[model samples]
Target: MNRFAALEAFVRVAETQSFSEAARRLRSSKSAISRNVSALESELGARLLNRTTRSLNLTEAGRAYFERVSRILADLDDADRALGQLQASPRGRLQVSAPMSFGFLHLAPAMPEFLARFPEVDVDLSLNDRFVDVVDEGFDVALRIGALPDSSLMARRIAPIRRTLCASPDYFRRRGTPQTPEDLKAHECLRNSNVARTQEWRFVDENGKPSLVAVSGRVSANNGDALRIFALSGFGVASLPTFIVGADLRSGALVSALDRFVPQDLAMNAVYPHSRHLSPKVRAFVDFLVARFGKRYWDPDDGRP
Candidate 1:
C-alpha cells in the first residue's frame, strides 16, 4: 500500500473513531479502510486501534502518531493549496535579464502597465549588454536580441529586431548620405564594438542577397546606446536596431542611410530554462511582450511609429 494513502486512512479512522464513518468520508469500502489502517499498524510494529464490539478507540501510541500525522497532512494540504493559487495567478518576484539599451528604452516603459495588469507580481530586472546564462544565472526569464546560439534553454520570439544603418541629420548633412553599401567606406562610420566583426557592416541587396561592407570608424563602443549617443552627437554613422533609433528617425533627429540596401531583420526572443510547465510570472511577462511588440511597432513605416 502507498504510505501516504495508508497514513491518510489511519488518520481518518482515528479522527472518526469508526471504520464505517472513515470509509463514508473517504468514499471507500470500510474493509479497504480497515486493511489500510492494519497495514499501517503492521509497518509501525504497534497496535493503533482498540477494537470493540460497540465502539472504536485509539491506543496511546495511535493518539501520539495521530497528533503529528494530522499536522503534517494539514501542512501538506496548505502547501498544495498555495501552489495552486500561485499557478492561477502570477504573484512573486520574477527575475529577468535584459540588454541595457533595450531594457531602458523599451521594457522599462512597458513595465508599469504590466504591473498594473498583474498587481501581485514584482519584477526584478537586471540590465546589462553582456550575454547571460538564463539557467546558470538563476534568471526566470531573459530578453535576447540577434541570432541565438544552440542551447538547452527554450526561446519564444517576442518581436522583430530590425537593424538599420543610420546617422544623425546633422552628420548626414555634413558627410552626405551613403547611396550604396560601398559608399560607407568613405564615411566616418561609428562602430558598435560588441559585434563579432567590428569593422564590417552587413546589408541585403534588392535581390535579397546579403553582403558585408568593410568599413572604418573613429568611435567604437561596446554598448549600442553609447554608439547611438555618439551618432546623435553627429560623430558618424552607426548600425543600430530600429527599436533604438525609430523615434529619432520619426522626429527627423536621424535619417536612414543607404535605404536601398536593406539590413537583415533579426529577432527579439524571450528565453527561459524550459518550455514545459513554466511559472505564471514568466509566462505572463513573455506573453505580454509578444502582444506588445510582435508587430514591429518601432518601424518608421508603421502607422504608430
Candidate 2:
C-alpha cells in the first residue's frame, strides 16, 4: 500500500473506531481495510491502530500523526471542492432513482426540458417501488415518499403529500357518506396492499388522538393508481396520496370521506447519502422539483382540481 493511501485508511479507522464501519463508508471490504492498515504499520515499523475484538484505539504515535494528517486531508478536500466548483459546466453521468408510476407521470415529463437546459449532464434514472441501496448500488440521488427509515441518507422535501380517504360520488350516494372516522368501519373500503397492514387505516381524531380503523374490502391492489381507478369506477372507498387523487377530488370525480379526521400533512422527499459535499446536479434537481411542485401542491382551493 502507498503511504498516503494507508494514512487515509488509518484516519478513517481512527475516526470511525471500527474497521467494518470505515470499510462501509469507503466502499471497501473489512479485510481490505485491515490489510491496508497492517501494511501501513509494517512500512512505518510502528503499529498505528490498537485493535481488539470489540473496540479499536490509536497508539500515542498514531494520535500525534493523526493530528497532523487530519489538517492535510482537510486541505486536500477543500482544494478538490474548490476546483470542482470552478468548472463552468457540470459534466458527468448522474444516476437517479424514483418510484415507477410517479417517474412516468411527473418526473419524466420534465426531463426533456432539464436535458435541454444542461447539455453537459447525462442522467441515468431508475424507476422502481422497492427501496434501493444508493451508495452500494452507486445511485447519486433517490426520490422517496412517505416515512423514511432512519439512516445516514440525507433527505429534502420536494413537495407535500397526504393519503386522502376518497370515494366516488356514486358509491357515496348509494352507501351514504361517512360523517366521522368511526363510520369508515361500516363502509366498504378498498385496501392498499402496499401499506404495512392492509386491514387497518389510520387517522387522527378531532382531539389529535391517533386511531386505526379496521377496514375490509373484496378487492385489494398493490398499485395505488389502480386502486384509485377502482375507486373511481365506484368499486369502494380508497385512501391514497393527495398527489394521486387531488385533481380528481377537485373535479368532483372523487369526493373525500371523513374530511375532518384526515391528516393534513406528509412530504415528498429527495434523498441521498448524507455526504458533506453533495453534487450540484442533485441539488439542482431537488430545487427544480420544489420550484415546480411546492408546499401547496394539494390545496383543494387551488384551480388544478
Candidate 3:
C-alpha cells in the first residue's frame, strides 16, 4: 500500500501493457504488481486500465497519471545518481567559514592552488571574527583558531597557532621592553576584544610553569589585522598570533618581548558537524589545509617569535 510503490507499479504496467512483463522487469511477482496497480486505482477512485484476455489498454486518466509519474520517477533517479556522484567525488559547492585575519592572509592566498587541484569543487568562503554555528548556519566546514570549547562538532587540528607579545622597535625604544610577564603591566598593551578574557594573558616559562598577567591597553580591537596594524605603528604591544605577525617579526618591523616565557600556544582546527560519512569536499579541503600548513609554517625557521 506504499503510495510511491503503487504509482511506480501502475506506470510500469501501463507502459508495458502487461502485468506479467512489468513484474518481470521489476523482479516482482505478477500478482503483487497487479495488486499494487489495483490499490492505486482504488485509492484514486478511477479506472486506470481496461483489460481483457487478448489485450490491455490504459484509460484516459491512466495516460495522464503515467505521464506525470514517469517524469517524477525519472527526476528522482537523476537526483539519486547526482547525490551518489557527489559523495564519490569532491564536486559541488563547498561552504566554508573562517576567521577574518587568517582567511584574508592565508586561506584566500591558497585558494588558487586548491581550486587548481580540486577543479570540480566550488568554494564559497565567508570570513568573520564572530563564532558561527556550523550546523545551524549550514556551513560545510569552518576554520577555528585557539582552543575549542566542548561541542558536538568534530574537529581536526590543521596547524599550531603560536603567539608572541611584540611591538615595533620604535615603541620598545620609547616605552622600553618588557623583560618578564609582569613587566607587561607597565606597558601600553593592545588587546583583542573578541576573546572572553581580553585583558588576561597567559604564558608558560621554559620549565612549563604558567603565569597569568592582567594587561591594560589604550586600544582594543576585535580583528587581529587591526591590532597588528596598531602594533606596527608603535601604538602598543600586541599579543598576536605568529601567522599574522611572522613576516613583520622576521623583518624587524616588530620585536618580541618576554622571550623566556612563551604565550600559551593554540591550534588552528577545522570543525564540521559530523565525522562519520564526511563528504569528500570537506575531507579534501581539511586535508589540503593540514598538508599545506605542516607543523609550524607560520612560525620563523629558527622558531623564534
Candidate 4:
C-alpha cells in the first residue's frame, strides 16, 4: 500500500463523508478509495469512521487524526507550490472569499483583467458579508474590509477603507443638517444591523478625540448596500463606506455630512492561513489587489461636504 495515497484517501473520505465523493475528488474508483481508507484504518488498528446506511460520521479519534492529517497535506501542497513559484507562471485554482458589496462593485470587475494576465490561474470567488474561517473553509485567501481582530492568519493590507455619513439631498432638505455629533439623535439614521453595537457610531473629533454617538433609526439592514439604497431613497442618514456610496455621492444622489468629524477608517485586507511557503496563486492575487487599489482610487474627492 502507498502510505501517502492511503493518507490522502482517508483525509478526502473524512472531509466529504462519502467514499463516492472522495473518489470523484481524488479521481479514483470508489472501491479504490475504500480500499485505501480501510488499509489505513487496519494499519492503525482504529476505525476512523462510523458509517451508517445513510450517513458517515467521524469517530473521536478520526476527528483528531483528520485535523493533523489535513495540516500535513496542506504543508505538502505548500512545498509543491513553493517549488512551482520558481516557474514563470502560477497555475492552480485560487479560492477567494470577499464581502458581497465589494465583490460586486470592485473585485468582480477586476477579475477579467486578472484572468487575462494570468492565463494559467482559475479563480473561485465566494461573496459573503459574514466572517469566514479561512482555513476551515478551505479558501486560498479572503478579502476582508474594516478593522481585523487578533488572529494567527497572515494578512496584507490591499487598500484603505474610508467611511462617511451621507443622506439623500431631499432628506437633508426635509430635516435640517446636523451640526454636531449630538445632533444625530434628533434625526433618523439608517443603521447596519450586521456590525456590533449597531446603533453606536464612532468617530474622531477635530481634536483627535474619540466620540461615540448612540444613533437610532426606523430602518436597519444587515447589508451596507441596502443601507445605501435607503439613504439614496431619502429614508434617513446612513453611515456608510465610501466604496458603496462614492458613485452616488459624486452624482448628487447622496451627499456626505459631518466632514469635520472624521469617520473611523478601516482597511481592505487579504488574509490567508499562515504557511512557511505561501502559494504563488495567493501571492499573485494579493499583489494584484494591492497594485489595483493601493491609492484609494475608488474614493471620490467631492463626496464629502
Each model's lDDT comes to: 0.85, 0.80, 0.86, 0.88
Measured with C-alpha atoms, the lDDT of residue 195 in candidate 4 is: 92
Candidate 4 yields a Cα-based lDDT of 0.88
Q: Write the per-residue lDDT of candidate 4 for residues 1-305, one digit (tens) a residue.
A: 99999999999988778899999999999999989999999999999999999999899999999888988997888677666565647678999999999999999999999999999999999999999988667788999988888987999999888888899999999998888888999999999999998989887788889888999989999999999988989989998888899888789898889977856568899999888777777778999999998877667885432
By lDDT rank, best first, the candidates go 4, 3, 1, 2
lDDT of 1: 0.85
Lowest summed lDDT across 10 adjacent residues in model 2 is found at: 296-305
How would you encode candidate 2's per-residue C-alpha lDDT over 40-97 as one tens digit per residue?
8898889787888877898999888776776577566756786565554665788889
**Candidate 2, position 128, lDDT:** 85
Clashes of 4: 0
Per-residue lDDT of candidate 1, residues 1-305 (tens digit) = 78998999998888777899889989999999999999999989999899999988888998888867876775676566655755588989998999999899889999999999999999999999899977535688999988899986789999878788888888888889888999998999888888799999888899889999999977899988888898889999988888889888888888887766866568899998753356778889999999988887778884432
After superposition, candidate 2 runs with Cα above 4 Å error: 3-79, 86-88, 295-299, 302-305
lDDT of 3 by residue, 1-305 (tens): 99988888888887778899889988999999999999988999999999999999988888788767876775666566656745587878999999999999999999999999999999999999899988546688999998899987899999878888899999999989888888889999899999999999888878888878999988999998999999999999998988899899889999988766875568899999653356778889999999998566667676443
Residue 232 displacement in candidate 4 (angstroms): 1.1
- All candidates' TM-scores? 0.70, 0.73, 0.71, 0.88
Error of 2 at 148 (Å): 2.6
Instruction: Point out the higher-scoring one by TM-score: 1 or 3.
Output: 3
